[model samples]
Structure formats: C-alpha cells, structure tokens
Target: MSGGVDSSVTAALLAEQDFDLSAVFMRNWDTKDELGADGKCEWEKDWHDVQQVCKLLDIPCRMVDLSREYWLRVFEPALRVWERGMTPNPDVDCNREIKFDALVQRLGESAQWIATGHYAHLQWDDATHRAMLCRSVDRHKDQSYFLAAVQEPQLRRFMFPISHMTKPQLRELAHARGLPTASREDSVGICFVGQKRRFEQFISEYIPPSPGKIVDEHGKVIGEHNGLWKFTIGESSRVSGLKTRFYVAKKDAERNEIVAVPGRDHPMLQCRAVNTIDWRWVWPDHDVQQVLALQTKLGGRFTTKIRHAMAEIECTPSQGTSPENVVLSFAHPDAGVAPGQTAALYLNEWCLGCGTITETTCTADLQESASSEPT
Candidate 1:
C-alpha cells in the first residue's frame, strides 16, 4: 500500500469481497542517502499511516526494503539520461521494473494475483486470449499510460479494484469506513523524492551542476545556465536577455549548451515527427511485418498521449530507425515533444503501448507554423 486513500480503499474493497489480502509497503527510497535530509525520513509518516490502516482492517502488514532494487533499476538509468542533459521519466521504469516485475517476483510467489490502486482497467480478450489494458472510467484520473510498459504476463497477474471508481468515491468510502487516511492530502511530485525538496535540488544531488552557456536559435549566446539538467524542454528560461520570456527548446549535450526561444509556442520547439526508443506493445503485436500491416489497415491512425493526464492527440505511426523504435507523426506540428519523455498510444479507450521519446524531426514548416501569441 502507498499509505494513501486510493490503496487503502483498494484493500478495503477487496476485503469486502472476501478476497484474502496482505499489505506490503515497498520502501524504495532512503532519506539517509540525501545530502539535505538532516537525518529525517519522510516515509515514516506514511509507514505509520499504513500500519494504522492495516490494524483497523485486521490484515497483516509488512515492509520490504526495495531501495537497492529501485536504485539499480530506476535511478541509474535516469541518472545517465540526466547527465546527457535530457529529461527522463523515472516513473515508467519504476512501474515496469520495480513495481510489476521485481516486486512481484519478490513477494507474489504464493499469491494468486497482485493488485494495486492504479486507475486502469483490464479486459480479457477472447479473440487474442490475452488481457488488454484499458482506460479507467474516471478518464480524468486514468493511469493506463504509466502502466503501458507492464508486459502481458505481468498484466494477467494484476488487478485494479478501483478501476471503475472515481477519486471522490474512494475518499467517500474511506470516510465511511473511518479510515485514518480518508482526509489525508495526497502525495505530490516524484514518488521517492518527497515534495519537501525542490525537484532541481533533488536532481542536483545525483547530477552535479555543469555551468554552461545559454544560446538562442541562431547560436548566439544570450545567457548562462548553472546546468543543462536543471531545465526541461518546455520550461521557461529564467535567464535574462530578451524583453519576453524564452522557453527552453533543446540541449546540445556535446557542447554543454542550452537553446532558448522567444515564445512557448516557438517553432524550434515544435516537431512533426518523433522517434521512440524501446517501444513496447501491450498485446502480442511484436512481428514487424504484422505491426506494419496492422498500421496500414488502420491507416496509421491513433490517439497519442504525450504526458500524464493530457487529452489524447491524433497522430500517425510508422517504423522508426530500427525494429526497437517507432516513429510517430502528429496530425499537427506539436510543441514540447521532449526526448526521454513517454509517448503512449491508444485506440479510443484501449491503451495500445508506449515508449520513451528518442528524437524528433523539427522542420522549417513546423517551426514557422507555431503560434506567435505572447504568454
């Protein structure tokens, strides 16, 4: 359990259904590793809440130290990306490697299935004889994108009890049951990195600052940055130069430089096509020819979600530089397509798959087409 209303409600609902349940709180982070912790671990509060909930529900609760696994599987890879001056979504690796794979292998040997509080749905397909991931009824809170990397075998052994229920419904149920976390505020920011520290401060602990020059689109140096890792693709450049605010457009890792533009919708930040690395399909569509045929039959049409909780945007798919890559072309030139970010594909409400963005094709037409409106 996450010591949150969602997971607590999940356990309560499962208990009501007479299903045997045991709570395991995976301690994936140790505050002692942080330079600014001052010997305080924030997860203690979560642990206390978890134990209280378990006691109230009359169920067994245990803590598993997965800090080593998390560091190896999630942290190392992300650190490499950050060092290269690119943003990486650690949650994707956390869900795929730590939560669904390593955690299950460690603790779910005897259990018939594993359940979590993720807001996603699973449907058994008679035709394919497989479990397909679907969007939750609460579309506003759908988490299928984050679960896209979870393989079919692991998905088959998973369950989401609150798939059809909304967040308000979960809070209401928790209040009725007198759960201690009923009115507790939800956790925010990165999972292991508590919100108490700024995101840049936490990241800088792993990736030491490398001072570099900030340049405009024409290679003109406008300002200087403490580190390229401190800025993301779409964030506003705090460095002073122009009359209007400039948004971070790209990073030159070799030169240790950042590129900023005049507006948020600047064409330099817009791209018509993006290449995804290590693309994973939720179903059994692994054969390249089969995938191509399926795309051709569907006219390569799909609704793509670039980030969490964002509305689906129309796009077309094609083969990328290699078999492991998939190239997605947006219906319209899109801004803020960042390398190392997730690009999740969907068909209506059924989540197809997802992959990490590797590269994008920024064309003159795309750049010129960007809106010139001031923000």
Candidate 2:
C-alpha cells in the first residue's frame, strides 16, 4: 500500500465489493539503520499510516519485510550501475523484482490476485491468451512505463483499482469516503532516496569518492569531478569558472572522465541510437518473433520511451550484436539518452516491454568539423 492516498482509496474502493480483502504493506526499505531528516524512521511512519487505513477499511493487514529481497535484487544491482557511471531506474527494477517477483512468491497460494494503486491497466489479450499492460485513462499519471519489465505471468495476476479514474477524481472519492490520506501528498522520485537529500549526497554514502577529470568535447581538461556518478548526461555541468553553461555529453567510464559540451542543444548530446542488453519482453516468445518479423518485412513499427513522462518516440527495433541485445534506432536524434536507463517499448497505448540501455550512438561526429571553433 505504501501508506499513500492512492492505495488508501484503493482499499476503500475494494471494501465495498464482495471480494476477500487483506492489506499487506511491503517494507522494501529498512529505516532502522538510518532515520529520516526529522530523526524518525520513515518506514515506521508509513507502516503506521497503512495500519490506520487498513483499520478504517476493516481488513486484515500485515507488514511483510522485503528489505533483504530489495537490497539484493534492486539496490545492489543499481549501485553497480551507478559505480559504472550509468543511470539506473531503480523504480522499474522494484516493480519487477520486489513487487512482482519476491512479494508474489511470499504470498504463495494464499492470495489469488494482487492489486495496487499504480496508474496502469491490465487487459486480457484474446489472441495471445496473455494479459497486456495498458496505459491508464489518466494519461498524465500513467505508470505503464515502470511496469514494462514485468512479465505476462505477473500481469495476469495483477489488478489496478484506480486505473480507470484520474488523479483528481480519485482524490475526490477519497475525500467523500473520508480516507485519512485524502489530502496526503503523492510520493515522488526514488523511494529510498527520500525527499530530504540530494541524489548525489545520498549515493555518496554508499560509493567511495573516485575523483575524475571533466573534459570538454575537444578533449581538453576543464575541471575535476568528485565522482562520475554525480553527473548525468544532458544535465548542466555546474562546473565553476566556466564563462558559458555546459552540459554533460558523455561519460567515458574506461577513462574515468566526463565529456562536457557548450550549449544545451549540442550535437554531442543527441543520440541517434540506443543499444540495450538483456532485453525483456512481456510476452517473451510471441513478442520477440513479432518484432523480428516486423523488422524483416517492414523495417520496424514501434514507439519507445527512454524515460517516464516523456512522449514516446518512433523507433525501429533490430537485433543488436547478440540475440539478447536489441538496438532501438530513433527516427530523430534523442538528447539525454543515457546508458543503464530502461527503454520501454509500446504499441500505441499497450506497453510491450523494456530493456536496459548499454550504449548510446550520438551525433558527435556531425560536429567534429566545428569542434575547433572557440566557445
């Protein structure tokens, strides 16, 4: 439930139905080691809220500690990606690894179906005999992108109670029903990071300082960086002593250096193609064959989103260097496409699946002739 308004309302809505209802709050983070900014355990507070909501709903509730599962499955893997100077979407991993895989296993045969407050829909596909992940009616609040890595089996047993309604509508219902969390603000950003600390500050505690050089596009050292993990591609390189603003164009992990370019719309920031490793499809067999056949017969016909909230871009998918790898060729150069980020695939409103980007082909070559020009 996460002790949020959406989940509270979800429980309330379900209580009116005849189905057997039991609320289980999965504690993915352990706050015993570290407290919040207010010097109180964050998860404890959330668990309290969950208890209150469940009490009002009159459902049997329990707390399932999945911190160990989350640490081994999501956090550790994400830390490795961060150490390599690549962006990692931990939320996507949490949905697939913790929520769907570990939590479902914990329930075992006790629960027939799992429901959540995620703003995504599940549609049963008659042709494929599988469940398809679809976008919520609230387009702005759609979260299908995060669930792209979830396989068909998990999708079949999942349900979203608030998928058909908008955020405002849901909140209104919560208010009418007197949900305690009716006015509670929605949670944002990564869960463990919390709202108090900067991402760089939070990550620094786990990763030791590995200082590196920050170089310009011309290969001239401009400044020093505390760590490559602190910087992300396409974000303004807040390096001191620069007359004009610069943005991070690339992270050369092998050299332990960052490539910064002048201007926000620099050619070096535009990525023409993204190559993903360990590509996962919701309907693994059928979807793989479908994309391959489409590529062979008619180039490609798929839209992809490298990150959430951004509009999907038309892309042509083809087999990458290996069978497990997939290359998504963007129709237009995409800026800020970073390695380690999940590239979610979709056919219109239906989310097909996603892959973790391993490399990005940029448009830096087009600007080689103009590189010598003074900034």
Candidate 3:
C-alpha cells in the first residue's frame, strides 16, 4: 500500500465493500531514498508505519519485491533512452511492468482485482464491454497523466476506490476510520533508479558523456557541455552559455553538439508541437473494431495534464489514421514537450491513454508540422 493515505483509504474502502482483501505492498527498487544526503535508501520508517496499519486492519500487509522486474522491464529501457539524450517517462512503464504485468503474476488468483491507491478511475463502458480509463474528479490530486500506457483490459480489471474523493476528503475518511496512514504526506516526486542527481551521476558512470559543444541558433560555440546525453530537447537545466535563461532547441547526437536559444520567447524554442499522440488498444491481439468504437465513444472535449502538478487543459481528440491510436490537439498549444516524454491524453479529468513522443512537428510550416524532431 506504499504507506500513503490514498492507498490506505483504498484498501479500507475495499474491505467495507465486503471483498476479502490483502494489502500487498509493491517494493519498487527505484525508490532508493533520494531524499537522503547519503546514497543508502531510508524508507524503513515508512515500511514500519505500513506494518502498523496492516496490523490495525487485520489484513496481511506484506512486501512483494519487484526489484528485478523493475530493473529489467522499466529502468533499463528508460536509462538507455536517457543516455541517448532523450527524456522518456519511466513511471508509465513502471505501471505496466509492476502494477499489471508483475503484480498479476505474483497475486495469481489471490485477488479478483489488483487495487492500489492510484487516483485514476477504471470502469467498463457497458456498451462496448471495453475498459475505459477516465480522470479522477479530484483534479488537484489526479494522476491519470502517468497512467496513459496502461492497457484497456487491465484498466477494466482495476478499481480506484478513492476516485471521487478529494485529498482532504480522503484524509477525513482515514482519520475517522482510524487508518494509520491518515496523516501521511503526499508521496509525489520522481522515483527512478539511483537518487535524484545521483541517478544522473550513476548513469554517466556506465554511459560515458562524450564532451559536446553548446552553441547558439547561429551556430556559434558559446560554451562547453558534458554531452548530448546530459541534455534533452527543450531542456534549460544547467546549460552553459549566455546570461539569460535558454532552452535546448535540439540535440545533435551524431555531431555531439547541443542547440540552445537565448530565451523562452524565441520562436523556434517556443514552437514545440505535441504530436504523435497514441491511444493503446485494450486487446491488441483481437479484432480492434470494438477498441476503435470505444475511442469513438470517448469522443468529447476532455482535459489534458502535461506536467504532473499542472492543472488540466481543456482539449478534444479526433480519430486519426489508426484505430488504436488517436490524434490529440489541444484547445491551445502547450510548452515544455521534451522529446521522448509522454503526451498524456485525458478526458473529463480522466486519462484516456497516452503515447510516447516519437516525433513533435512544429507550426513553422504545414509540412514541417507533420514531422517534428525526435526527443
């Protein structure tokens, strides 16, 4: 249950529904205690708190170590992409790998629906008999943005009990029910392999950062950068150069150079396109007509959340070239689309689905907008 308030309430609510429940905790290896100054992970106190909660509820709360699965399936692929100077979202993969893939295998008929404290909602669209992922009502606490990669069938098999409750409401529910996690602060931050900055350092250890030149749009070398892997498209993180803030315009992996613009107001740097939006099929191996029809059913002016903490932007998605994938165009343009990151799609604050940003065409020209640069 991750020793968090949302999850505690979820488990507690499930019990109230008269379902036999076991509070299974997923020990994700990526949570290596970045909050600590030293390298060692320090979530021991958190686990102890979870143990106390399980004891109080009289449910078997045990840890399922999914470290190897996490590394092999989730971290490795993301690490490789990061090493290549792209910024792919690993949490999307973590859900598919641990939540649906590994958790199903481990729980193995022990539970009917593998539930967690996630703030996203999953229910079968009765007409289509296909699972549809929707945004949680608690807009401030919704996490559908990170759940775009979850398959549709798995979405049907899951339940988010706290989908309708706000964080304050959840806290009140927990405190009233005497759940030990009632006061646990929200666990919202990055949890990749290694620590925060340590992850970058550890990656550089194995993936050597060949020195690259940091240049202006005019191709004048203003300063030196570690390597292309150390930067991402639209990244302004610690780049060396002119006085004002600048964003990465592009990363030339072949030339081992980085292109930067002096400020956010620059047209080229600001003209990032949110394209190649994809919606996954619940049953990819079966006839996809039902899935396509499901997408048609989801047609509406929904909302979109790009960054985790940002509020949802009103948007509408249309049927594109493929049945499984949908083309999403926002009511207005969005910024900070680092290549390889997910353009998470949603409707009514619910996550419809998301796809990796393989290409982001710009508005510079109609033809160029059809084919964007890779992250």
Which one is best on TM-score?
2
Better of 2 and 3 by lDDT: 2
Per-residue lDDT of 62-180 in model 1, one digit per residue for the tens? 99888899989998989899888877888878999999988888985777888898999999977777998999988888889899888788899989999999888889999999999
lDDT of 2 by residue, 174-283 (tens): 99988888999988899998877788888998999998899998899999898889999999887889898999999989999999999978888988888898888888
Writing each residue's lDDT as its tens digit, candidate 3 over 1-375 gives 877788888878887777777887777763443233455453555577778888887788888888788878987898787767777777878887788888888988777887878887776766768876766778777777777777776676688888888889999999999998788777644565322355566566567767878888789887788767677666684655457987887777678788787666555554334555445533444223443454578665456565777756665555556654455556655555566777666544445566666554444334354567565
Q: In angstroms, what RMSD does candidate 2 have relative to the true structure?
A: 3.6
Candidate 2: which stretches are off by over 4 Å? Answer: 34-39, 287-289, 292-301, 366-375
**Clash list (residue pairs), candidate 2:** none
Off by over 4 Å in 1: 33-39, 287-301, 363-375
Roughly what TM-score does model 1 have, to 2 decimal places? Answer: 0.93
The Cα error of candidate 2 at residue 42, in Å, is 1.2
- Ordered list by TM-score, greatest first: 2, 1, 3
In model 3, where is the ten-residue run with the lowest total lDDT? 282-291
- What would the TM-scores of all predictions be? 0.93, 0.93, 0.83
* List of clashing residue pairs for candidate 3: 134-350, 135-349, 135-350, 339-375, 360-372, 361-372
